[model samples]
Target: MSAMYGHRAKRFPKLPEHRRDQQIPDAFRTTMAGEYFMLGQSASRHILVLATSSNIRLMATRRTWALDGTFKIVPQWYQQLFTIHAFAAGKLLPLVYCLCTDKDIGTYGFKSQALIIRAAALEVDLNPDTNICDFETALIPAIQGYFPNARAVHRIAGELGLKTRYRQHEETRRKIRMLLATAFLPVPHVNTGVSLLEAGTTGTLAALFQYFRQEWMTDERLPLWNVHNIRTNNHLEGWHNRLNRKAGKSHNGLYELLQLLIAEQGVMDTLIQQVLSGNAAVGDLRRVNKVYAQKQRQVARYTGEYTNVRRTLKQFLEALIRVRAAMYGHRAKRFPRLSEHRHDLVLADQFKTTKSGEDFLLCQSNCRHILVFATGTNIRLLAACRTWGMDGTFKIVPQWYQQLFTIHAFVAGKLVPAVYCLCTGKDIGTYGYIFQALIDKAAVLEVDLNPDTIICDFETALIPAIRGYFPNTRVQGCYFHFCQAVHRKVGELGLKTRYRQHEETRRKIRMLLATAFLPVPHVNTGVSLLEAGTTGTLAALFQYFRQEWMTDERLPLWNVHSVNIRTNNHLEGWHNRLNRKAGKCHNGFYEQFHILIAEQGVMDTLIQQVLSGNVTVGDLRRVNRVYAQKQRRVAQYTGEYTNGRRTLEQFLAALMYLTPEPI
Candidate 1:
């Protein structure tokens, strides 16, 4: 008996053994009324769309559409059963069903194209004013690509897990409802309403507002979700529930599901006929009437027809605040003034430790907050590295500090920040104190912090302080800063216009800066070549360069020949990243400290990954195409000079040609 039942089941229409098969039996390719149902299938058989002629005609007349996908009711060969529904005789009815092999943008694109092509063949316009769907990131762009004129409304509030939160807390429920009310606002006032609500929120509610801003308030999605009369795709969900109940089981056989869909189409045809002939009622009007009445009341309130005058966005927000106060009583202040003065504030215990609970705060005193943020492993890496980069950023420093000074070490080919100091002064005394603190901390950790080369800018006070602290260390000035100094001198001598318009003047000035790239012995000769026939602003520029940069004590500081890493650009880029993370200039002391702590946490993870051989750090900096080409030319010229093919004068001219504008 079991064998006979198996044979009978096999005789029934079955799905293809492989999903790659695109052929469909003729008997199952049409609806019960003999209307073609299998509209189209993709060439790869990854997507198949089905719709009858009458349903397509009905879909063409509707102005709104709701799309959704169901998984449980699909056959084993398919991933999901996707559906598109439209209003027919005042009821939402599924007009199209698609069997997709995958849930990606490409599959949806195929489905959209099939419908468009079929509609064009039947000469039925498929333009919709509004399309409703869930927040599937892949589906939104696919729908927009095929119907650019349609406004795609995403059901955000339903899917964000807000319903459970709303029912739990009264005050939170009121705030969440107010957030939903933003949908009813005029498109121009939506952002205003959100900002007003955001200002009044704090703690977890503030985080919720941030998420909303990031996900829904973007320019492309803002207009898509902000409709005056917002509608949801809840009706489509109900239709899926009905289809599941009719099927009686999950993962129904392909033939059985097709039969059920044909019967559904037949029922829809009869209902459509009944409503057209005036023999049956269209739909449940009570629920729709209630919705419309609520929308009208909201519109009347906004226009002041129900009261006195049109209300502003502020007035609407104030009304919500007043209602909340009436129901829940007055709330406390969101952000109270800090009790301690900005200069008196101290780091909390939590901020004193690294994310791994290691001691991170090396010293905190009245003069400076010297933070040596290296773990034991990081200290070892620092001791082993031969080069270091040091710089400070004043813009991101706390108001109580003069600058955020950072020390970076080259580790495994990547320049990683090793120490941070918040100093109250940019003087020799403050810098000396910072270095002393670092030395003391290194002594305690049993690691010596000595580097062979230190790269920095030509800060008048910083250079002298660095030399005094690390007398044996080699100090190399940034090559980019050298060019900037020469350009500034040119401007000071009132040669800005001549430098830009006169090619000879510009080349002479550039050659003066390009001497930094020459071999140490030849740099003076290169400068002397540029010194001949100099007068007026050009002579003054040369004198300034000699007095400031070429003195017996200053020559080696700026000359970068044979130096592997010339500029502190990697450190500068790190500072830029910190500025972006700080989000504003001169944040509060604790706020900036928190940002630093987060940065240390990231460094900790990276250190572990590096030690474990999971990550390989690349070049310290990335050079653009133009600068790379210039470097190639410089290399070629240097090679010629090394082989005695080119004279010193030719090398200087080639280097000058490659000099870029001050960066």
Candidate 2:
């Protein structure tokens, strides 16, 4: 009879017969004190704020707030168990419990019940200085609408975790990881780096670009991930995790959930006392404060490497972090996994478009090799040329390898980079791999790519491979590289800067080294002159030059009188342009890939322009216009009488007047 009497009598039906929003009667609205215990609510929505006491409301009014949710403690009918934690005295105290009907913008009672007005009644500021929350799509709109003036600090860890598992391929997957790694970087730098990373992504990987822009790259979301601030809602997350364990795994009823909150109120009161006494606090609050102090000092002491033309952003960051770590006698932390960085090498088939949407990545043939061309026509022009120029740049290659080498050839009289190769090392085997790939590619296209002459620096490892494969081809050395090598020997011999000042000795030493560029008969004559020359520094430099360059009649290999060009200036120019396009020496793989694709477009444009008769002799000649003009004039004088007809005075005064004015 007593148990039956405790149940409510249902003689009349309530407002909605099937309404899920069970009403809380006036009997449960207040505590022992006459002051209002539950926060104000309306019948239009199911809003019952638990533990909204004067003391808790007062503490919440003057402090920051973190709103979080847990599913484990929620009733079977409810969507989630929402908690609003007040950050006071460096601890997050659970001040309110909001049993939400559903996880949606409409389900929240902020608008329907006038949540801000009710909070104002308890002296609680609805809009605090900062409000930290998870990156929940539903929560974001509600918070933005309610707290327009408050700074929204969305936790970025959740987004970063989602991004780590974003793409399928390793290349794109790596880039997605880098997005989070770059969060600590300065804003402008992040903007630029993000754009570059975006350009490198395609196919399945490209989806992350939109994801980043939507979830993390928004203006409101950008500043939250700065290195100095709290980028994750660890405090709220930790509380939810503890609450979940406390409630156990099974779903509870509405009455049980309220009872759970009643128990939480006791714990909250205990935590409030601890916070006031400056005892134990949230782990995030303690650790972030402790680490930030040391981080600021370390960051200040270790002057970081600023990003520059020579150093890539990633390289600079790595060095900066390493320097900081070294100051503390620790290993540097590696941030951002190099993502789409290896796209060109690892996932070679994906990057297939250009800025103008052309077939930029010409071949996805082999993983061991990258045979890049500006266009299909570059192959044809390369095949037509009898001589090929080759050079490698160590600084401009991807960090994974030794050098970015290119094979150049004169196409329509303008020397252009024909084949770009990413070499693993500057060895005979590497060069053999490159040449064999080219030969195989040519066979597939039914085009003859065998060159009559191959010009390059004295890379011994490469020289043998070229000769062994293209046995009949003439191998020539660059005069500029040869001269640079001779100069290097002079430095090693300790001649000092004064070596060039001593004109007589300098000319004599040069004449001896110049023997390599002379005829077979004259080679011995020059060496003999050197042996008969004076016996000081000149003798030492000349003897070394002779033993190295003059031995075994090697003079014939460097004698440019037989080849069309002497210097590897075209090869050097190609490398310089490529380095600039790539933006750094040790560029990321994706960066190098983008550069290679762009280089293809540049070559194709030049080739098309030259073949169309748009490029004149003046354009082909990088020297002064007067030189090209003089060459053209000389061509017109093919039928001129004996050379004696043009006297020295006529050549000097008449030609000097024809020097074109500088534009």
Candidate 3:
């Protein structure tokens, strides 16, 4: 039966040998319902477009259109299989399919012209309000040339190639995301947003901005890519994926591909008929994801406010942070078995010691399970290091624990994880107990562990606990966390909108954060300068800052001027690495324990290599060029202030100028 079926399938006529010899057969020139399926071909016979009459008529009614080309599913003779989709009744329908031998401007121009002539013959107007596509130099101009009144909106397809670079550099990722957010800015403020982004970039980012300026900043193309109200071309790209799946393979013969397209059209026709008859609902084929819906709401709100002159470009950019936060802030659901696995005896024994049989489990209780994976070498390094970095990650913790807390020591010019603790809660009692465990273990090992400074985030309970356990140690807050706190306070005080629209307001708010860079003695003077002439939200902001950060004891914790390493970003990076290794949020207890044990072994080997001078660990934290430049400017300002060349107010103003807007 299989052999006979194969023989029957091969009985069809041979396909064309080349583009020049290609000809549509009479049987394939019309739809199954007898409407013209081969709508038109280019004069050079190099481009052929297929669309039934109903497809053209439906496309003419749509105000928005999307165009894209895919090469993977194209036959070997053609350059690509280009598609034009129409958004009708909330469904993105592929209305026209074109096969082209070239991807040049002439080829696209011919395709556009053919569509226009075909639509004219059917006495239907084919004018779209917006056209979405990738940043194809040839296709963009072709669309603009034929449809001068239509707005061209470019998709984010151009930036997909930079995904790896984005993952490696957080600052670069933030800047690139902000660039995409420029599309949501008001038409008049789009250039201003781009300019602000360009001013803060350097190195590779400078080259990226240069490309953006040259290709997308021109008068003719500026409006083409700014699509604040329109949807992206993701749905159109999805349709192409479906087509590839239906065809089963790439480079199908001419007849085979046509048959697939015809079948797709038949399905679409049935859907259209059902929708028109009220038997089916007419909307997006797939439900919008929650994150995407929230982002759309935010954009809509921001744009609505812009029209009323109540919102500014800076606010829109700030709102992008909220949008991004929404994407990553979702809490993972807990699994009952995963949480209970912490009490399993076999798993407990498995995780109680290092692979070499050293004591890795420091404490295991009903309320908490504190696992210290550091070997004795790590403990010695910890005792020798004066400045320790501490942080915690909640995403990858087992369901039974609240956070996977870590303590890192600066070893051989690199921050190395010295301890890992899985805590059941974030209260002061839990933190004090964990610190006590470390102290008692150090006593047993005869390693005196004393640190001059400990850098951590502003976790209220953890800070006091650290100070309580080590009376002489100074707990310095991360500078990044300090800025984040001030930004959050700005939102709390209802000053976010003002900060976004008013430059003076924004500068004053930034000056509050810049106080971190000032010497301890001069910080009060800087805050006094910012406090002058303040009323309303600004007054409240400075008041909150003074109470929370400028007290006699609290002042020293956040003042990072004399601190060489001002942020715990390295510790945060390590936690991220651990999260990736765990592979999923809220992993099984034994699985997380296994991952940590393996990491401890790796750390032991790394420590030995470092001590023997066989390996050197470079800075794990990525140095952001813009931030480094800002630091240099701060240093210059501080020196001038110390030399009496600038007044306190002058120094604060200069530092404020160097402060970056919260992303």
Candidate 4:
């Protein structure tokens, strides 16, 4: 009793004469003595058993120690302490200060405060500055100094390197501490003080993380410098918590925690392997199913139909019951029913057959129009190919295009988009009018554009009328028309040879421009190739080109101009996504098609940004710069120009002019 509070004031006294007549029974006292001795023996024996474990010994010797807290005394004890402290000190300290300084007081705060005020008050006041220094310099040590029993116990523990024993009922508390520490390794250890440890259970992992950075590791260099070292091996925690909570009445909680940790690790390893095998979504689904199975077994006692409340039990219990059912339940429902197939739909959707007869869902394709729809990030290609010829009835609607544009507002900090139209087998004029209606609707919606922007389409004669209405716009002939004109002008064989020559010229252009970054001497071979107008397919392709193509400043634009402006690959890609929903059975999209396409564009844009690494890709940064630069160089044409010089300030001004306003 004295050890509990550290002040030796009152002791139990002998009974008075009248009470002596009603003497205490020897049998009752003996029974009480035996029970108390047995309780003490059990506690000591349990501690000894922990000490005997090799794992415990090894952990104790290590410098690292995981700390946690458990409530020890009841609320009545709290009330008693408050009354006693108030009686001695005349009043409780201001509640705000009491709350604020409460954390600073560690274990045995009552004993420490009592001794400091009574026994050590004179020594402390004799030299206020020195005592304050002692108080501040070693607050934790001073608290321990006031209680001889606690100090002795802690000294023995520190000397022997004894790992503190956790309360039997508080294993969850200890595990939480260990899990948090492991997740944030190489970070300075968390305080593990009573308040912080208790806070971990209720707070989010992110909140605890911020707290660790701000409170525990107060060094200025903290968090920013040490962020990379923090390890988040939370897979075990996820599995353990699920399994522990799922443990049936038959199973011990401690054994379930350990067993589930082991099982969860195995399952995660398998799932990761499946993902690496190219079915990550499917693999995740499979793991989810397995967890459900385990939960079913754990909850088998409430065996009921899918429609029953038992079946509706949450995943934590459901997984345990399912696992047990799969393993040992004789009367439980067997394999998942056919209706379960709907649950697997999302996973099944992720799988596809490769061209080589392999079961791979994700494979790169050659057709750019269809390809961009799947991978999402092809705005530059979309814009360039808008003029290409598309034989199908698929079309681009203006209203939908504006909606798509609004969704993507920015791509890697640039504004680029594909044209939109309706598919029609009606004459070009009729199709053109349909596009006009969409444009009018877009205007009503107040869709913002460059005002100077020009949209060109297959309705060649209509371009001038559209441009007349929007004077800032200039309509360019579709590359699709130009490519078709070239074939009509030549023959099929000639068209094939011309295409091959075009590729060769592009390759030579790249080689010539390779060292241009350094401003070195030009290669004679490159110069010769540029000057010589040889009688081959390459020369024929460029034979009747505009004077703009001859200029140095416009040369880069020329390469893409033929592929995009001359052809309609850009518009065709949008048609393909819309057509995919309709398939060959339908000639054109119905009313729902417009909204679906618009919504799909939003999804694809987000996917593209993710793939391009404008945002961090799972902690990796700047992942797209090298790829973007390479693609830019490979896709463009280049030649030396006579008068293309502009100062950096002028360039910046021009860039600002070209940039889009924020939505």
Candidate 5:
């Protein structure tokens, strides 16, 4: 029997099927099943008590059970018992062949039924009386029975006087360990420098000495050149370990797994594209030449005049190729393979519209120049201009490198240009790279750098380039650039005073500048000027040029007659107008550079009309006044100027008459 316990407790709880919910005496219900608390317990917890209360309940109604060659049919409560009986019987087959027949005190009685079931699942058995260890402890040895042939055959061969293969297996393991250790050692040094040796023998010591001596003898200035090399096997092992952790345990192989890793970290190709878009250098070739010059300066011995350094120069050229491949094609490995999607792609023939309504296309004909203009906008489209100083422009490199250095002028958080130079064959020398075929063909041409006038807001690099190329040109700093520089200087001085208070201080500085000889000691103190003839020098000149005429009395503001008078507010207002017209996100530097030129062209015409005193507010107000319901703000702000023929004495007398001295 299956160790039946508390028979009286099981038997005395029986109740007729129809009397399941009958109200019985409290004492009888509480005392039923030999437990006094049965009556107080909730119905859910009292299920086991109720099941034992009646035999008909155990055999109750039709409960669905389907057997498809898996197990014997049994009552719901007895199914587990039946399965245990079957398993126990199978394990003890060599010991017993008889099947249990009696229903009472029967059904595989005296068996450790739970143990038998577990043993069968694990494919192992233990004595019923002996307490077996837990599943975790016994699982490995128990599972070994499932593949019994491998174990049993080995045992049989050992008993039958046949030698075991254990020694041979150990030898194989030793060979594998030796191979791995050897592979872990450093390989022959490919490129010579500081290197880790597999064996620190006399040969390695001599080789290191030779390498240093060779470098010292060849390039005497740079004696200690540091070089490092990582073995491929070790590098690969580390990479694989990192990849496994990134992928987790779910990923099975490298093919799909690498894609996930690439996606997470971002593909080199996508990063290269991002860098290209921001780079103003990618389309300019002169920049590449400058880079070559810089490299030549650094390793002068390696790059001597033409012949002596030919091989070294070729090596450097190869390095440049590697850099360009990584930047343009996302090729890091020597054997570069582009995706089918990339290979199948065709160059986009369509043009992108810029903020100023100019159509822009990539200029592939010449990488050195960027073209910007609008069609039929002016006599000849004024081109946008910016130049790169290295191969990064023409040869191609990481887009990030380009983005870091590319200059874009923004006003009121919008893109703008300080100036646009319209160039032709007559001004080719003044406008660099305009002769290039792509710029010539472009509806809007872009001049790399203009020599005629140096803009105030020109890039730091462009400043020197302009000075070098156009020695005699009037390099005017834009009024905006001058103001910014002043503000920066003021901030550096820790002057916390507001701009209003600073106005007088600024005017005194500005007026002192107008006088050829500066009498202000404070302004000249610790200041340096290139030419002594100029009062305060270029620095003061730059400050005075940026004067805003609306409120500043320092310098005479822009007058129609003045050829090149400047106002900082003019460029600010002009940039604001362009941004208000086109406020969409900029797609790329090249496109924005072009749009700025087109906007400048329209603005130039407007400025010309205002300068000529011909711009009228009536026409603009008449059109938009209905909806806007307001007059147009004056298109221009001018100082009070009467046709002056009076002498300073007459002006002083009039001023004196208006207000006599306070005393």
Candidate 6:
């Protein structure tokens, strides 16, 4: 606080109560404008005046009067010590000094008389252009009555010093603060901000609403605080503060004040020299600048839901910090303890229970930065399924995490999402950690977590990790993913335009793309694009096929005819829906937890519909009847029951046994 005030008062006026005012009438007798004290003559009060000199008053080129009143340094007989300063050369210098005995409306009427007498004594007209003050109700009317042409401008127009007598709850108080801050904004935005506050408020806030409307947003107060280029009253406040320290507090005696006035003559000489030498004293705005910068930073940090609430909370907490620091021995400057992200507050709690009253967050590893969310029911469904489908989406994933990965399985022939995890890496090791954790947790529920077949996209990292982690499960790469990989290669080799120009070329290229459906033994031969054409895309497609697809042992996984499902479309559909629900943009770390809990709600609903006995996949099963029959016949013809390879004659005979008449 001391540093914030800049220059301090070094000189003190050695004065006591009655002597300060009693000797004032005699003290100014030899000055440029003689002193006058009239008691009970002006009204029902005493008036003492030591007005500015005629020459100084005549120097008022700009007719702006800055008036203020203080009471602590006045004599016991006086009620208030008033000073009127005139603005000249961009500075406010004292023009008139008066001490009044009462605070009545009639007493203030006498202030007008004193100013009129001073103006007439200086041979200058009393009409002024503008009057600047702290907007004291009594003094304003008196200043206006005295100088009717002077436009009153109140410099105390900001929300910093607002005092409310009404009691309010915490949330209500915050709303009030925000509404009041609009006073410092541009005129157009002030009304809009107030209206937003009013729309969101009710009950006791209406009282606050009325208070703001009457006091802050009033027609007279608007221009003073608006971007109307009005100057602040810091200059007047600084002068009053310096005056208090020099007078040394309490009531002053006449003889002590006479000596003080004699000292003030020397003080004015030094001040006048400093001002004329282009070295006028300015108040310290460092503290004010820091606070305003902090406010702008907070505005940049929050948006939509947290913007207003975060501002209110940060201010309240900062005040609490100062109060606590002052009470204890801690430093007052060390305000607001920093912590993790704000949304972490709720996410840490969500680890206990979800919105649907279920244990939501199963496990979180801070070191690995992996979060795994799965309800017990979803785990059970995953354990019961013989086959699983997996997919990952980068779009809807939280900003804290890289991607959203989920495992889904067919339940009653309708695919249902079971487990979701947010892992730190797309590497094989990260996927290994995630799967190992899932396997351990599922074991606790007395369920076998391994699936017979795991269907997924052809992410190179994913395939190897699934094979390494779950050795027994057969990993089947999705047929659509396989085609997508080849499609990308076609574009890379610049064959897409040629493929599109000729429909026959397009058809042959797609057939080669669909070679993932052929059995591994014939997969290469089935994609022979040269048989269809010898030019353009056909020749390039075969070269890419032999170099990229044929060299991998995972070729068998892309054999769509051997898998229970040819594509992981269910998982992709789920990703699309989640991306839409979670919105287009990314989310925060804890925001993902909230979204996962929402996905938990989705699983909860899917489970309910599955058990409700109303929903069924009967039609879907019937549609796949012929495909199922074909799968069984192919299994027999392939001779999976015996280790020895079957002869072509024996395999055809076995295939004929399962191939009954079509009727």
Best by lDDT: 3
Q: Please report, in order, the local distance difference test score of every candidate based on alpha carbons.
A: 0.74, 0.60, 0.76, 0.29, 0.28, 0.60
lDDT of 2: 0.60
After superposition, candidate 6 runs with Cα above 4 Å error:
1-347, 528-537, 608-615, 618-663
lDDT of 1 by residue, 332-440 (tens): 2322233234445465787788878877787776435444444565666567678989999998786556888998887654778878888777787777887787777
Model 3 lDDT tens row, 1-663: 122233435744565434566677887787677777897776465788998877877778779999998776776457889999987666788889998888888988888888888889889988998899988879888988999888888765465236556766777787788887887766788888889888967767788888888977788777777776774798887788667656655577667777777788877886655543556554435565777778778878877876787877677777776686776555322212232245552344657788878778776555455444556667777787898999889987865678888999876547888888888788898888878878887888898888999999988899999989988898898987788788889988898778866889988887787788788998898888788999988899999998888888788888878566888977887776676566556876666877888988878777666556676445334555555565576677778988999887777667665454443
Residue-wise C-alpha lDDT for candidate 6, range 117-210, written one tens digit per residue = 6566667667778777776767767766767777777764444322332222456555655554454444665676677768856555676677
Q: For candidate 2, give the lDDT of residue 435.
A: 76
Error of model 4, residue 240, in angstroms: 47
Whose TM-score is higher: candidate 4's or candidate 6's?
6
| Candidate 4 lDDT, 10-33, residue by residue in tens | 222222222113232232222211
Steric overlap count per candidate: 0, 5, 1, 41, 17, 8
Off by over 4 Å in 4: 1-450, 454-462, 476-533, 536-571, 585-627, 631-663
Worst 10 residues of 6 by lDDT: 1-10
Per-prediction CA RMSD (Å): 20.4, 31.4, 25.0, 31.9, 33.3, 33.5
Residue 209 of model 5 has an lDDT of 38
lDDT of 3: 0.76
Point out where model 2 deviates above 4 Å: 1-345, 348-350, 353-375, 609-663
Deviation in Å, model 1, residue 542 alpha carbon: 1.0
Assess candidate 6 and give its TM-score to the true structure: 0.44
